[model samples]
Target: VFIGLGVPLYQGYGLTETSPVVSVNTVEHNIPSSIGRPLQGVEVKIGESDELLVKGDSVMMGYWQDDEATRRVINDDGWLHTGDKARIEDGFIFITGRLKDIIVMANGEKVAPVDMEHAILEETLFEQVLVVGEARPHLAALAVLNQKEWEKFAADNNFQDAEKHSEQVEQAILERISDALHEFPGYAQIYQLGIVDEPWTVENDLLTSTLKMRRNKIQDTYQDLIESLYKK
Candidate 1:
C-alpha cells in the first residue's frame, strides 16, 4: 500500500531502556523485512540464546534505584540484554522472536514458536495459533480455525462435523501444519494439535493490549485441552 501510494516507509527496532532509538533504516540503505543497521554509536550483538544485546552511549545507566533489576538486564560489561531473539545478516538485524517466549522441549531443543505460528497461519485455515511444548517430549499447538476457510475445507473433505473435533479433521489439520513447517527443523515440527472454536482477543484477556498473545493466560485457560494432547 505504501509503495502504491509512493510513500517510503521503513521498519526499525528499539527499546525504552536504550533511550527509545537503537536502529533504523535510512533512505540510502533501506532493507525490507529488517530493523536496519545499528546507530553510529550503538553497538548490537546476538548474545546467549540468540538474545539481542546492546551497548553504547545511548544505553541507560541503570533502573531508578533498583540495582538488582538493573543488574539483571545490564551486565557488568555494560551490555544490556534486549530480551529479543534476532539475527544479523549483512548488517541488517531481523528479529525472530522473544527470548522469554522460547519453548524448551524435554530433549533440550529450543523452539521459537513465533516463527512456527506465523508459518502455520499462512495456510489461511487457521486464524490464530499458539505452539506449546515446555518440558514435554514434543511440540503441540492450539489453534483457532478460520470459520470461512474451515467450512470450505470440511465440505471439500466430506467431513460431517465441521465445527467440532474428529480424528479425520485433526489429521487433516496436522497435515496442513506439517506442510507449513516443512522448512523448519524436524524437531520443530508439531506432533499434536488442539483446535479451538473461539478466537483469542484482548477483550477476553487471552491477548495483550497490543494484540500479542498472553501465552500464560491462554495456557491456563486451555490447560485441560493441552494436557489431553500430551496424554494421547
Candidate 2:
C-alpha cells in the first residue's frame, strides 16, 4: 500500500525558527485526516486570522542575522507567528492547504489538488500526478507512469519491444485510473489526464535532484499533449 517510512505520524508543528519539527503524531489520541497534537514543550494557539502561532523551548532565540525579521514574527506575547494557515477541530489540526496552493473554484469551492491527486496515486497507475486548472469548473491532471516496471512486464509477456509495452502501459493506466476515480466527486475527478512519454528527471530540468517536479515547466513542456487530453 501507499505508505511512508515514518509513522507519517502526526504531531507537533514547527517553524523555520524552531528547527523545523516541534510536534508530531501520537498514537494514544490519533485522528484521521488530522496532523496530531502539539509536542510536550510547545505552546500553540489560534491567531486572530486562525493561523497557527507557536512558542516553545525549541523555538529559536531569533533570526540569526535578520534582526528586523526576528522582531516581526515574535510578538509581545513571545509567540512566533507561523505564516502557515490551519485550523483545529475536535482537538486535531487540519491544514487546508499551503498559503500558495489554495484555490477557490468558480463555484466557490476551495480545492486542494493534492488531496485528490493522492487518491489517484493510491491506485498505483501513476508514480506522480499534478492536478491543475485551478479556479476552473473541472479538474485535470498530468500523469506520469512507472515506465521502467511496465517495460519489465513487457518482456515477461513476450511483447519483445518497448513500443508494444508502452502502449500496454497507457491502456493499463487509463483503466486503473478510471476505476480508482469512482470515489471522487464529478467536479473533483480528473476529467482528462495528460500522458507524458518521457519521464521526469533532474538532468532535464523537469524536476529537482530530489525529484520534486517543476510543475510550471512540465506543463509548458507538454502543453500540447496536456490540452489534447481535454479535447472532445
Candidate 3:
C-alpha cells in the first residue's frame, strides 16, 4: 500500500483447523485491506486476550479421531483457537501477528517484528528479514539482501565486488530499508540492521523444507552480530 502498487489484492486469515478458510476479503464484499467479515455460517471473535477464535460447520469436527489432541485446540464450546493474534473492528478482522512472535522491548514496548520485516521486503531489496529485539532497547533486523538487486544497487552506486561486505554498502542498504519503513511507527522502526552474508536454506538448517525460518537457529548462527547490534 505504501508504494501504491495498483495490485488488487485481498488478504484472508484462517488455520488448518478451520477447514483452511474462515475470513476472506472477496470481490463482491471486499474491504480492500481487511480480512473481510466472517464467512457465511462461520462465526469469528477475538477472545478477551486478542486471540482469534472461530466456530462453525466449516471448522473440522476434530483432529482426525485424536480426541486428546483435538481437545487441546478446540474448547468445550467448540471454538477453534487460531494461534494468530488479531483485532475486530466493524466486523472486519485485522491480524496483527502471531502471539508467540511478539517482542517486548526493555521499556515495556511491544512490537511485532514480522510486520516490520514484511514492510522492508516490499522494497524488494531484501529477500529475507528477521526483526529481533526481545527484551532489548530497540528493534534490530538480520537481513539477507537480494543478491541480484544488491548487485544492481552496487552498479548504480559505482561500487565493485558487491558480494563483499563494505560499510558504504551497508549504509546504502539501510537507507533503502529506512525508506521502505516510512509507514511504520517510531518504536517499530529498525534501529540496527545486520546484513546476513548467506541466504537461508533448508540445507543450512536455517529454513525448514516448507520454507519457514527457524528463528532459534538464525539467532544462534548470528549471536555475535546480534550482540554487536546492541553494543554500548
Candidate 4:
C-alpha cells in the first residue's frame, strides 16, 4: 500500500548498543522481508543458537559502569551479542525471535514461541496468542478470540452455544492451528490449548509500555488454565 501511494518505506534492523544502525533496505536493493545487508564496515555473523553477533567500529565499548553486565554481552573478541535469533541468506538478515524468550521442554528441546504465536495469529479468528511449553511434554497455547470472527464461525457451524472452551470450539481451533503450523517441525505442533475472551493489553498489566508481552505475568494470571492444559 505504501508503494502504491508512492511512499518508499524501508525496514531496518539495529540496537542502541551498535550505534543504532545495523542493516537497512534501500530503494536500489530492497527485499521486503529481509532487514537488508549489514552496513559498510559492519561485520555480522551467527553465533551459538543462531544468535546474531556483531563486531564493528560502531559497537559500543561496554555498558557504563557495569563491567559484569558488559562482559555478559560482549565477548573477549569484541563480538556483541544482539540477543535476537536471526538468519542470513544472500547477505540479507531475517530475525526469527528473541533468545531470551525461547521455551525449553523437559526433554531439552528449545522452541521459540514468538514464531509459533505469529503463525497462529494469522488465522484471523484469534486476536492474541501466547504459546507455552516450558519444561513440559509438548507445546500449548492460550488464545484470545476475535469476537466478531468467532460469532460468525459459530453461526456457520450451527452451534447453539459459542462457549469459548467448549469441546467443539477447541477442536475447530486446533484444526486451524494445525494448518497454520504445517510447515513447522513435529515438535513445534501444539498439543493442547486454552481459550480466553479477554485480550492482554498495557492497561491490563499483561503488556509492557513498549507493547511487548509480559510473559511471566500473563502465565501467572492464567496459571489455572495453563495447568489444566498440561493435565490433559
For every candidate in turn, the CA RMSD to the true structure comes to 1.3, 6.0, 4.7, 1.7
For model 4, which pairs clash?
none
Best by TM-score: 1
Who is ahead in lDDT, 2 or 3? 3
Write down the TM-score of every candidate: 0.95, 0.61, 0.73, 0.93
Residue-by-residue lDDT tens digits, candidate 4, 1-232? 9878987778899999999899999989888778989999899999999999999999999999999999999999999999999999999999988898999998899999999999888999889999999999899999988989888878987765547678777888799999999999999999898988789999999999999999999999999999998887
Q: What overall lDDT goes with each candidate model?
A: 0.93, 0.69, 0.84, 0.92
Candidate scoring better on TM-score of 1 and 3: 1
Point out where model 3 deviates above 4 Å.
1-41, 55-80, 87-96, 162-164
Q: Write the per-residue lDDT of candidate 2 for residues 6-69, one digit (tens) a residue.
A: 5444445566787777556676886656777777788777885556788888888888798898
List model 1 lDDT by residue over 23-71, tens digit each: 9998999986789999999999999999899999999999999999999
Q: How big is the positional error of residue 70 in model 4, measured in Å on the Cα after superposition?
A: 1.4
Candidate 4 lDDT for residue 115: 90
Candidate no. 1 TM-score = 0.95
Residue 149, candidate 4: Cα error in Å is: 1.5
